[model samples]
Target: MRKIMTNKTSKYILLLICSMSLLSCEKFLDKQPNDMLNLDQVFSIRLETERYLANVYSYIPDPLVCNGVNYTPLSDEADWVFNWPHQQINTGNWSPVNTPYDIWSKYYKGIRAASTFINRVSECKECDELNPGITVQYREEARVLRAFYYFLLIRQYGPVTILPDVPLAIDAPLSEMQLPRNSYDECVDFIVSELDKAQQVLPDKQSNTREYGRTSAGMARALKARVLLYAASPLWNGNTDYADFKNKDGKQLVNQVYDQNKWRKAAEAAKSVIDKMPEGLYKKNGTDGKFDPFLSYQYVFLDRWNTEVIWARPMTGDAVRWERCSAPRQINGYIGLGPSQQLVDEYEMENGMSPFTAASTTANPVINPASGYTETGFSTTATKFTKAGIHNMYVGREPRFYATVGFNGMDWVYKGADGKTIIRVELFSTGKDGYNGSNDHSTTGYTTVKYVHPESDVRNGRHVLKSWIFFRLAEFYLNYAEALNEYDPQNPDIYKYINLIRERGGIPSLPEGLNQDQIRERIRHERRIELALEEHRFWDVKRWKIAEQTDAAPIYGMNVTTGTSFSDQNFYKRKITESRTFQKKHFLWPVPQYEIERNTELVQNPEW
Candidate 1:
């Protein structure tokens, strides 16, 4: 975002205030010249209008900022100090009155900004005069963004009223403005239609350096891929629980019957993103003429506007907070964000096989025991690949696992005053990052080494920050693969897309003989591993309607106890860190109680 997307320093908002100056012939008052820039001034200039759109772009949530159990903790993906708000949500203790992640107002404001920009931009004489055809693109961008905001609103709240071009005037009668919510299907249709229109107008790429983070045709398609994916999923796909729910007009809020075509539509949308776009998995070529998965996956977030990135948001100064909060305690970082043993177990072996039944502790079992994968103790010999001794639990795993998790006795690549040095990780109970006091210790005895740039100096407070990707080429492939598996399981394209992600991740692709159900779980597993903690698992598990099973599973961690030998005191015991609760009602978040109170026309989601 720093490259060209300017952050309007103090222009925090656009307030609506109307005043009429009629029949004031005799009045002589000091008006102070009213330096306040109005809609006329804003739309008149191209840059100012862009600034308004940039404000809407700001509404796009940064996936890196994890507030008090908000992200990794909210899902079974990871655990931290267990913030109360996250605990409440995970344990099903939250409600409409005390909502945890309410974005209704925030997104609506973005929708409003987009609506206002799209409505008034064409009327600006100077804008068209100066920018020529660019205004059309700007308008389309705003329209697509408005659609995205609506998508955000509906994803959590189930369905939201699709606001029109001009929000009803403030002075209007309540009946005129307090509109009822649209059905889920209507919202989906509107989002899809808006994106289609946006795609026709948006450029394939924002060619100018000034428009690096700006929306493009690819983003519109990428968003459509996600939107349609949700629409095709079970949560929104003909769930009879909401059969009785309807709007004031008696139109059903949830669609009544399952549409098999929805999956085909989703697959096509995702396939378009892959087949038509220039984007693909971010690959760093090795000297040996191969793609390095660890470096590729790590740098996908580290590299700015890299090849695979479909949409990205700059972290700005907020990255340092994430670095400090997520850094391991040994490095004077909180080690606050720790990947769960559950997440750890989910990563397959390098041979592309699950370790679900491995010879490990029942609490935190490893999969694929045939690979000799073990949590037995520290490695007897240094791995030739890393040239540092890694624990057996940390060994024989895929490159992504090595790239993502920082386990006990694993080599830590840190940039010091001299240069890049490799040191073993010590996460024993009394070890540097072990569980002694929870202040900065890792609750799971594992650190999220995924985004920690090798050069970040935790003790010195230096950070290695880069653009956070909202969508990537790998996801498009995954999305298509998942949907295709659901619809056309026999389609060779299903295995093709899934294998693309697997090949990029250094895992062997599916050979053959795998059925639809097996492919479905594999697609989900790949998503869980590939897109870990990018804020997808929290929603994906819920959207798949498997959160009750997945989220309810107890969050697990390592209870490291250092003793005499490798298997003695250093033996890492699995511990149940915390028990979680998930219900069918928890699938969709309740609308804010205040929103229901404010608008009598608004209907709450079922059970709320």
Candidate 2:
């Protein structure tokens, strides 16, 4: 969603000095785009200042993009068909120096840009000359973006030095910049306060296509809700695992005492955003066809700037890189991403019930055979089912199941021949997306069809520019439901919000007679399904401190070897794709070794 504005009259640009000793002086960001200009020349005009903020926004990472890590692969949500940069971390092999993704350098670089903008934007009267009405709005954007970067920094690497208003001088002494990391509470307070201030200046929404993907009142509040949610999570609030964790100054990095008010604050912030979403959750009905939850969910991503999206990155032309990374190998795609069976099982039955009555082990997954979950054999066209000519295990499941995972024998209809036609996914050993050979195929027996546009012609390299959604209304409701239940265990509103999400997915609402724990369990289930591969599950598992249980287990897939022929194939048998490891120390990512080595004053995260 980042489009950097350019100016042909680019005489010079502001290159703020990297933070003294604490921050790596290594140039990150396009840190020195235009360096020869004086301060007055850089910030004196509207075009120059606009270009500065645009470059800062460029630093925001998209979820699906592969850096050192692919989001889905890092979590238990999926496995990669191709070798991923994050494999080391996924297999519990990363150290401080060797992380999946390094946020320390990236965000600090962004923070420097933002802090510089705030400190110098006011001095630029020429910018106000161009458009008086929008000058303050631009400044507020930089501020809110700065706070957002801090929020991002703290989430990945525990506590960080809070650079609120003061910008680092290009010539500042190294000693003056080697500040210690702020306490968890301090960083939270600063971010929440900044977002509150930003709301007053930013517009209520993106005004039009011209202002699309820019900072807005909704984005600020939505981010505030997210920051608070993490703050109140068990990993941050009352987390004794980091109780002994302190900086070199002896100040604690994480808050050990559990505070109920944190959850209350999170709930209030979430509700505030939820109240503003007049459209509420998106419903898929406008199209001329039967109301399908699958299409609705699919189009929420496909149709950018819909009722659900609060913040997104709109791209033009084709999404070539995205398609190459996630598409199926049979379609001349890289086939890098495969939804894991662990995630596949999370999709409940159509009745809104758990698929596994009790799956203590993946090998003998106790799926409810009563719900028409047949593993082997094929059905006929006259058989009352969506997958009439497909395997029973892939049919009659939740709408999201069909919308997300592409399984063997599943009818994958796309533009073909003379008109649109169905091509059954023949993943039976010698079949297209399953056979192991020269090409990379799905390791999990299923490739993610959720993000890929059904109309996208991977064969001809045809693809539409898709938006990377950062925030949406549905997440706020989920956030509100989670926080409310944590603060008031018996809160009835929790069930309403969670069920609202489920109803859109064509699943029945939660039945009555459930307690707080039951409600929370259902909410977690809904989040996994509703927000799968959206970059939330990975953070949720960590913040909930349940990674030891979730990430440490072996990943599962179908018994691909046994499925040699379509007529006689093995479907339900589970095969261990890969074993993962997660220790309690993994709750927080280590501050990079380079950062620690540069400044001895900086304290490393525990057990690194």
For 1-608, candidate 1 gives per-residue lDDT tens digits of: 11122234111111110001111211211221133788788777655665565555656666566552246688888887746477778777888999887888889888987888888878666545654565677688788879888998888888789887686666988778788998898899999999998888887665553345667888999999999999999989988878877876787899979999999999999989998765567888666787788788878878777888887765545556666777766667777778888888888878877766635444745456566677665565666344344557767788898778877766676777677766665677666666664567677778887777888777676666566678888888899999998898889988888888888888898868987887887888899999987888988987788888888888888774442322443346678777888877787888899999888888888787
Clashing pairs in 1: 355-366, 355-367, 355-368, 356-367, 561-569, 562-569, 563-569, 563-570
Best TM-score among the predictions, by candidate number: 2
Off by over 4 Å in 2: 1-33, 66-69, 286-290, 316-319, 381-385, 416-421
**On residues 385-465, what C-alpha lDDT tens digit does candidate 2 reach at each position?**
265667666656788887777777666655544555566665656666655543577677777777677676776766655
In model 1, what lDDT does residue 466 have?
67
For all candidates in order, the CA lDDT equals 0.74, 0.74
**Alpha-carbon TM-score of each model against the true structure:** 0.90, 0.91
TM-score of 2: 0.91
Judge candidate 1 against the unseen true structure and give its global Cα lDDT, from 0 to 1: 0.74
Candidate 2 positional error at 59, Å: 0.5
CA error at residue 150 for candidate 2, angstroms: 1.1
